[model samples]
Target chain A: MTTGAKRPKRQTAKRTPPKAPPPWDPSIVVFACNWCSYAGADTAGVSRIQHQPHFRMIRVMCSGRIQPGFVLRAFEKGADGVLVSGCHFGDCHYIFGNERAVEQFEKTKEVVKLLGLEEGRLRLEWISAAEGVRFAQVINEFTDQVRTLGPSPWNGKRQQSVGRAAGQRPTTES
Target chain B: MPELAEAAKKTKAWACYDCGKCTATCPIARVGGSYSPRRHVLATNLGQQREIVENNTLFTCLTCSLCDRRCPAQVTYTELVRDLRELSHGHGVEPECPHGGALQSVMRMMAKGGTQQNRMGWLSQDLKTESAKGQVFYWTGCTMYYDAFFPEFQVKTLEGTRSAVRLMNKLGINPVVSPDERCCGHDLLWNGDRKSFELLAEHNVKLVANSGAELLVTSCAECLRTWKVDYEPFFGAKPPRIVHVTEYLAEHLPDLKFDTDRAAGTGPDGDGSRGPVRVTYQDPCRLGRHLGIYFAPRQLLEALPGVELSEMRRSEAAAICCAGGTWSNCDRFAKQIQVERLREARATGAQVLVTACPKCQVHFRCAMKDPNLGGEIEIEMRDVVELVDQAVGQK
Candidate 1:
């Protein structure tokens, strides 16, 4: 049975006081809606399933609330990875809410690259409240992907990295 | 490949297990208590064609992404719903919405310039067949051009779109425009006018081919959805590069200097004294759900500096439809769904409701006036372009 405690440090090194790691362990923020994805996480807890400890979740009423700018803001605030979880199509507590997330994911993928982030760093998934195992699997997979991508360019080298290469603006690469 | 598109293309109707989650969650599904996606999909798969098409449930769909966002199989339920509506229309089944008069009026206005076609008129002044002399053409859909109720919005749309064109021009790319541009079969396709849709598609595709313009840019979400998704298959040729105006604008906003003041939340009195307003945004189904255009509008809104953009309880993929989606044309049913949408928007505590689609703006505005919705909320609706227009001194 999984305990509700934070996972033991794995491949993470503590840095000097007052400063984040130079090659920081990636931070991920997941915005999960209450109806499906959030409940899925809740089910994971109830089921005693274990997942990665790389993410901090914020519960939203629906996946439709996830704006691409919020993902960009998370990235700007040093989030190396972001996950948006919603109900599968036709399962939203609000009709069409998950579909909006599906559409937004397309543009968000482009925007992430436009900001120079790696592909798959940000993900949109449809995880029902009953799918505890799926939720655990998605979190673990996303955590590993972010680990490979490393810290976002915006987070490291605060002084020298001002703009442009810092992934602030849209680029032709998207 | 986006999963929504892939799923929509692949999934068969019987895949749905009839969880009733989609109907229960739908903003419009509760209207008259007669709408249900699970039932509709089940019926369609069972070949209960006559019954499914005749039912008012199909029209109750706001075409919102809520069901799409929640489906476990990613069944693309909404597309199936749209197909049902088309079938119903094919059988000469008429929805209860007053869409007929509105669409006819809107189409007539598009043929002749009027207040409705303000944005298109603005385009006529700045762009022309001569300007769009290259191998590109702009499909000025009816919503952007002939929607008179949204004058301020139309102007802002032109300004932002023009800014993008200017940037492209500076980049040594001169995309052409045709003053003779007509609707891209968005309304016809959505409303089940398949024959008209085909004619317009053929006509527009031929026009673009003859003009030698390989690119097409439009500010309308519906146009982008139809042109890219529906028409491309029919043409059997590489479709033009159809882009939403916001996508084009975000690419160039940093280079353009514009002064915009934030209008967060204000009371019914339009007073700023109510402490910084807690503002939220609603994603139009086409722009947010169909096209994945959640960021561009948010970037435009967030760029205003002090505006605290709190998200709606249901946003992006999970957003409730404004109830004015293409299928909402069936009168009493559409209004019923609109009422539900108003309640959801009111729940956001956002004094000002912002969206990109003119249809959403109109529905939200009308819904706010319903006496049944508990005496009104001091909410104002505006397009994203209107806000940008105010910022750039074009207002």
Candidate 2:
């Protein structure tokens, strides 16, 4: 049987191996407010709550500090999804920081949508510091949602091809 | 430093003979800022690269090209500022962009490519647009972004773009409006981000080329100048002929039908019922001084029945800038320039301050928000296309 299998090696060489695309995992960026959502993420960690491990947390002083630029920069740098988590309304440490975050998030949402990203890819949620299980739930939910949407158009292969296409174009003048 | 000398030689900054005309003509200098085109030229000529970069006047220039008009030696002052800015940007010196650089970040993100944009959300059911191939391609620029970013301004930048398309539709032409059309990179190039600008330009050039369009029409003055002047040299063979929307519409003046009666009675302040609706033209520096599109907009405005075109004191080549350009250095100086320009517009005795540039509309409206000004400079602002669309009776 081993000799028979070896006899087909010449036939195998004539056929190309099937190219299996690498299994894709969502790359999510979570912008957490230091006073609330960041602490919530910490609590989830300390509680050993099992959440999706795909997200990277960036702690900002206040939710208001997350400008549209911050979220845009994340997408520009090829983030699959971005979650801007903040303190609940009226529960903000600085009185109205979360309110301002709502305003900024609306603007960011418009830009993100206009840029043709999936509506679910960008989200704003109010997570309290004590809500460890809730943080884990949000994380797992967001990661699963992003996974269903597949890799962002800005991700690896598409980006490389775009660069290659631009490079291939004729440059008639300097 | 050698790049600075090269820039100087290329722009003919060496031809400057210490003449104060450029300084006198500079809007920033007029507003009492230390920004002088002549001073920068002298510094570049003397090879004082460090002084020029550290002084940071390079970003302060509005690059309106007004100084180019005043220069007897024909020195291209605006190009010098642009090249110097490109150098400064390479050295990691970033401009103090307004709105905390949110707008700039949006533009930079677009430059990255491969981000599919839903730019056609503004295209309504009535407006006919072809996506794949057409003779005319309408480049929307960043109107949708601006509309979302500055909702408080109530300028409705996208509305002007929509009006442009509607006008084209009325002329029995279905323009190709690409959803993948990116920013013209006018702001990025002027802000000294050459690499990002090139990326956007390449994407746009390829998009238009693939669309098989022979004529590319844009409503934005900055985008028009960018496509016509900056992007032309870098484009591959057989680039489409770029024209401003007003310029294109002006050519087909005979074909356009306007409802003069409706336009006369539809003034915001109810003053149009008395006589022809008086509108003063605010020459966007890009359209006027840069592209020399002085008559096209005026020609279109005059063609609209019941719409009287009032020229401001500083109209045409002498027009003041919208104060803000390239989204950089929008400081008290910019506000002052805006306030003064608004006051001039108010003095023209025209109820409507009509401008062809969306930035001019945005800047002037922003200046009007000054609580202290208190209705003194509160003239109604409208884009030329919006008025034309109204006069044509949007079906």
DockQ of each: 0.01, 0.43
Q: List model 2's recovered fraction of native interface contacts, to 2 decimals.
A: 0.61
Docking quality level of the chain pair in candidate 2 = acceptable
Model 1 alpha-carbon drift over 4 Å, by segment: A1-174, B1-11, B99-131, B135-137, B144-146, B149-175, B235-238, B260-279, B327-333, B343-351, B371-375
Say which candidate scores most in DockQ.
Answer: 2
lDDT by residue for model 1 over B1-395, one digit each (tens)?
A: 13223333455555777777777776655566566778877676666766675565566666666777778767777777666666777778655534223343233223222111123344434333344458555555554333332332232344434544544444345666564565676765666556667766776677677676667776667777887788786663665677776666576677545543433333323465545544567787888888788998888777753355678766777776777666345457667666655566778777667776656666666665666665565366666655554444422
Chain A TM-score relative to the true structure, per candidate: 0.74, 0.79
Give the poorly placed runs of model 2, Cα more than 4 Å off: A1-25, A155-174, B268-273
* Model 1, position B388: C-alpha lDDT score: 51
In candidate 1 the C-alpha lDDT for residue A147 amounts to: 67
